[model samples]
Target: MNTSASHDPNCIFCKIIAGQIPSKKVCEDEQVYAFHDINPWAPVHFMLVPKAHISSMAQLGQEHAALMGHIMTLAPRLALEQGCNPYPDGGFRVVVNTGAEGGQEVQHLHVHVMGGPRPWAKG
Candidate 1:
């Protein structure tokens, strides 16, 4: 719930957002930063992260509702823009790894958007 900080100098995502680290950016705005995963799980694999330094989903509170909704609504558009086929038959998957047990590699909260063809190595 300590969402006051806009960036974390030690957080990798923050560095990517601040341009201190290079990333294959998909899209970015005042609220979120979307970038391609270096080790893609699917043909179209990217992540959408908040500009603010939120450690993980466990830290999210009701105050983050609007931001979370914005991320959800924006996912499809970004997925399509990244070459994921349209919905119904071809769509994307949104994943949020909560903590260490949940498989989050980085401390920064990010929604993994993966889609495109089958035979993907893993999700």
Candidate 2:
């Protein structure tokens, strides 16, 4: 959760998780949904969103931390699904953008798993 869905009635990420806005589904559970980013920055850029709309990491508590742990544990697996590898020439990056200053555009809590061969290469 990086932005404030609490105030946005038309938040796209929220609608996607709620099944109101469709997206390229990747991984999902009762707690979260992971999908490819519509506008990708890396070879692999997928977002893992919690089904519960919690706005920002600052609002997170012990319960949310536990859920966050679960999200991290799945990040690597999700990255692999997007073709990320962890070898010398293959690996991935996991990121959680917290606010506008952190480059977050969505308000709902989500994790970004991105990488692949030469994933970190600068073009």
Candidate 3:
């Protein structure tokens, strides 16, 4: 996911990182990008994605483990920033949609940060 979606030339995420596409950015770094999802699944449904453009989990090998850990760590931190665990509450959900059958919309790998439980939380 962090390999440069630009390779596709039509990658929406790459276009976004390149400023060719528009997105409501939540965070950004040299190696990653975070933004609000177009069709959010939850109140805090944001995306933390690597800039490398790695397509799916199956495509990731040894080199990706570090980045994966970083993504996971970043998720909870960002969730807290977004007001997760507010009041006496606690925790949020981070989802990685792996493949087409897994409900991944974009080809780029992205971590879905979800908070403020909704109806979908039940099933």
- In model 2, the number of clashes is 5
Better of 2 and 3 by lDDT: 3
Per-model TM-score on C-alpha atoms: 0.95, 0.83, 0.85
lDDT against the true structure, per candidate, is 0.92, 0.76, 0.77
State model 1's lDDT: 0.92
Q: Residue 86 CA error for candidate 1 (Å)?
A: 1.0
The RMSD (Cα, Å) of candidate 2 is: 3.2
- Single out the weakest 10-residue window by summed lDDT for candidate 2: 1-10
Give lDDT tens digits, candidate 3, residues 1-123: 234333556777767877788898888887889998898767777899788877877678787889888888888888888767753566778787778888787888788888875554733
Candidate 1 lDDT trough over 10 residues, lowest sum: 1-10
By TM-score, the better pick of 1 and 3 is 1
Candidate 1, residues 1-123, lDDT tens digits: the string is 555478889999999999999999999999999999999899999999999999999889898899999999999999999999998989888999988899999999999999998878574
User: 1 or 3, which is superior by lDDT?
Assistant: 1
lDDT of 2 by residue, 1-123 (tens): 233333345667778877787799999987788888897878888999887777767668766777888898888877776788765667787778888998778777678777875535443
